[model samples]
Target: MASWLARHGIQPTVVERASALRLGGNGVDVRGDAVTVVERMGLLPRVRELATDVRGMQFVDATGRAVARIHTQDPASPEIMRGDLVALLRAATDVDVLLGDSIRALEQDDDGVHVTFEHSPARRFDPVVGADGMHSNVRRIAFGPEERFITFKDHYFAFADTDAALGEDRWVTMFNTPGKMAGIYRSGNHAQAKAYFMFRSAPLDYDHRDVAEHKRLVSEAFAGEAGWRTRQLLDSALTDPGFYFDALGQVRMNSWSDGRVVLLGDAAWCASPASGAGAELALVGAYRLAGELAAANGDHRVVFPRYDAAHRPLVNDKQQIGPNVRLKVPKTDGGRCVRDVVARLPLMKAMSAVERRAQARNARPLPDFTRAA
Candidate 1:
């Protein structure tokens, strides 16, 4: 967002809660319009160079034998490690960033917003954008509580660094038992592997900011599992300091703006990791937001609504992740069997091809926001 705004002669001050840039996460896909976003940023070549190169998913049995496999490679969509993408974006952006500081209060009037921060001196900006993740601090201050927007999707998941040798090369090997799934993502281009775990569950009580609590939740969820390298993966993941665990949830909002304050990316509409569209939604939404602001000559009233109207369709589309979740962690043994059978069939690949073509035909051309101003 800072990079896009800077391109349009707008200087943006980035406030980050963490002391340093966060460069740890699982693989994120950059496809469709997001590919254009990166291309415009002059990072497409580098992104491709750092791509995960994962071929497909391999479903395994109890003894760690591959039972079925699905080819998911697509030239149109390239998967890159989240940390690599973040590093590329950071290098591309030239802006002042206030690290280890957070907004304490936001008092908005007709002219601008009055801001107070936790560590830095208070400063006012004409418009404040919340690009924070699902539990956005700006949204809580400017709008209402998180309960009004966040919808839990009946599951929780965790992922962390693991041994590369645990799984087959160039494939995400998954082992499932009814509602639970234990998997290893072995990126063809990277030496480090990632362990993924997910299970069906009702909303559990835990602090989002507490890493110890997160580890415990994940451990408890996979405690009894001993099949197909589950114990090995779990033990490795639990020890990693960069382990990430979160509820499979989505952020839905009627509007993304409130006066001079507006939201973008996961703050406005997080379709969750299950959608495999976080990077896509964020890149496109930020470009549109900054472009609209530039076109309106920094007029929040004009830019906010335009930005919301332009990006909502893509968010709506990505938030439909029901099928994705079911595919990963089936509800029953029969369902898993059916999924494995379907995955092994050529029809699944053909259907995916058909779906991609249909999406391409239906998708509106991404606007050339560079010329909008």
Candidate 2:
């Protein structure tokens, strides 16, 4: 967003709560319109160079034998580690970024918005955009309480760094027991592997920022499982200082803007990680929002609704995750067995191919924002 706006003669100030760019996360897919977005930014070559090159997902038995494997390689959709993509985006964007500080208050008038920061002095800007993630501080301050927007998806998940040697090369090895799954994501191109865990549960009460509590919940969920590297992965993940934990949830909003304050990325409409569309949505949505603003000469009223209209359909489509979560963490042993049997059949591959073809046929061409600029 900052990059696009700067190209159109609009200077954007980015305020971040983190001390620096967060460069650690699970792999994210860059496909469809997001590919066009990266190409426009002149970062496509570098992005392709850093692709994860993972082949597929493999379901493993408790005895560490592969029960079923699903090939997921797609030439059009390159999967890259989240940290690599973040680094590339940071290097591509040229703007003033105020790290370690965040918005404290916002007051809008006809002229502009008066802003107060956590550690910086009060200043005013023409408009404020919230690109913060699902638990957006900007959303809470401007839109209201989070419960009004966030819908819990009956699950919790965690991921952290783990020993690469523990997992197979270029495969996501998963072991499921009832409503829980423990897995290792070993990217063929990266030295570090990530331990992934997900379990079905009612929403738990806890502070989102409390790392210790997150670790405790994850530990308790997988403590009984002592097979197929689960115990080892759990220990390694819990020991990692940068462990990530959160509820699998989505954000739904009637509108993406409230006066001069607007939301984007996960702050506006998050389809959750299960959808495998976070990076794609963020890239395409940011490009569209920035393009709309440029076309309207930074007029929030003119651009906000247009941006919302242009981007909502894609967001709505991605939010329908269908069988993604269930496919990963089956609710019962019988379901797991059925999933394995179905996965082993050629029908799964055929269905996936059909879905991809239909998507390609229906996909609208991405707009050329440079022409507008």
Candidate 3:
């Protein structure tokens, strides 16, 4: 967002609450039109070089037995670690960034937005955007509390750095019990492995920033659940400071902008990580938002509406998980067994072919920003 805005004659100041750009994150996927956004920025080669070379996914039994497999040959969508992608984006943009600081308050008028920072001096700008993640502070201050928009999917998920010995190289090995799923993602490019855990339950009550409490919650949720190296993964991740845990949810808002303040990425429309479209939505949303703002001479009233119209269709489509949810978290032993059987059947291939065709038909070509540029 900073880069695109700057390229189009807008001075952007990026405020990050983190002391620095965090380099620790799980693999993030660049699918569909997000590839165009990267290529247009001349970072496609860099992204591909750092891409996690995951062969595909494999469903396994508790006894380390592979029951079914999916080998993807699709190059249009590649997975790269979230931190590496963020690094690439940071390198692409030349903007003034204030670290360890965030917006304390925002007062937007017809002319501009008056802002106060947590650790920086007060200032005003023509627009202020809350591109923060799902539980965005900006969203809370500007739009209201998070519970109004965050619809929990009745599941909590966690991913953290773990021992690579837990999984075989090049394949994401997953195991499922009723109401829960656990997996290890083995990226050949990176020596360290990532542990993924998800369990279906009522909404959890815990502070979002409390890592220790989050670990305890995860361990408790998976307690007594045996097999598939669950004990070891939990043990390792509980001590690892990089543990990530949160409820699986999506942010649905009728509007992306309020006066001169607006939202972007997961803050505005989080389809959840399960959709594998978070990065795509953020990339395309940022590109379109900046383009609209630039085209309108920074007049957000016109820019926000145009941006919404151009982007919502893609988001609405990507938000649909459909059968993917069943494939991820089977609610019963019978469901898991049936999925295994379906994977071995010819119907799996037919579904894959149909999905590929739909993808081709719904290809969202990036608007020719050359004219807008």
Candidate 4:
């Protein structure tokens, strides 16, 4: 968002709640039009350098035998660690990003917006966009409460930094049990590893900000569940301080804009991790949002609608659960076995063909904002 805005005449002040950039996350992929957007931004080469060249995903059993392997070799797509990507993006932009502060309240009128912050003095801006992510403070203050938009996907997921050697280089190793899955991903580009845990559950009642509560929930859920290195992964999760836990959820809303304040990226339409399109959506959304605003000559009212019309289709399509979630976390043992069997069969080839076509169709044509604006 910052990068695109600065390319035009507008300079946006990025206000981050974290004291510093929290550079810890799982690998994120850029596919289709999103790859084009980064190319336009002139960061394509840098992205490729840091890309986690994961050979494939391997489903394993308790005895460490490979049930199946899906070789993820797409010349057009490359998955990069989220932290490294963000750092690169930050370096690319010259915008003033204020850290350790957030909007406390917002008031909008015919002219502009009045914003009060938790730490900084109250100020106003002509167009105040909430790129604040899924649990967006800007959305809460301007649009409505969060519960109105957030739809939980009957599951929970977490990832943490770990030195737990997955023993497999350039492969994501996953073990499935009834209603749960635990995985270890090792990148050939990086020495450090990551641990991922997911499970089927009803809406969990816990504080979003409390890491202890989230950790407790994960620990209790996989307390005795046995499978390939589940015990070791759980132990690693317990010891890691940089753990991330959240419900698998998507943000569905009627409209993304409210008066002069608008939402961008996950704050507006989070398709969740299951979609494998969060980073893609975010990059494309940011590019379009800034582009529309520039095209409209900084008119929030006109730009907001234009941005909505251009971006929502791709967002809607990606929100569907489809094969990505089911293929990874089958709810029952028999279902998991079926998945394993199918993954190893010729049927897997057909599924990949279908996915390729869908991705092509979903890759919407991004307006050349650099030229058009």
- Best prediction by lDDT: 2
TM-score of 4: 0.97
Predictions in order: lDDT: 0.91, 0.92, 0.87, 0.88
Worst 10 residues of 3 by lDDT: 363-372
Q: Each candidate's TM vs. the true structure?
A: 0.97, 0.98, 0.96, 0.97
* Residue 214 error, candidate 2, Å: 0.6
Candidate 2 vs candidate 3: the lDDT winner is 2
Clashes of each: 0, 0, 0, 0
108-174 per-residue lDDT for model 1 (tens digits): 9999999999989999899999988999999999998999999999999999999888889999999
Better of 2 and 4 by TM-score: 2
- Runs in model 1 with CA error above 4 Å? none
lDDT by residue (tens digit), candidate 3, 269-325: 999878888988899899989988888888888988888888887877777766776
Residue pairs clashing, model 4: none
User: Could you tell me which residue pairs clash in candidate 2?
Assistant: none
Task: Output candidate 4 Cα RMSD.
Answer: 1.3
| Prediction 2 TM-score vs. true | 0.98
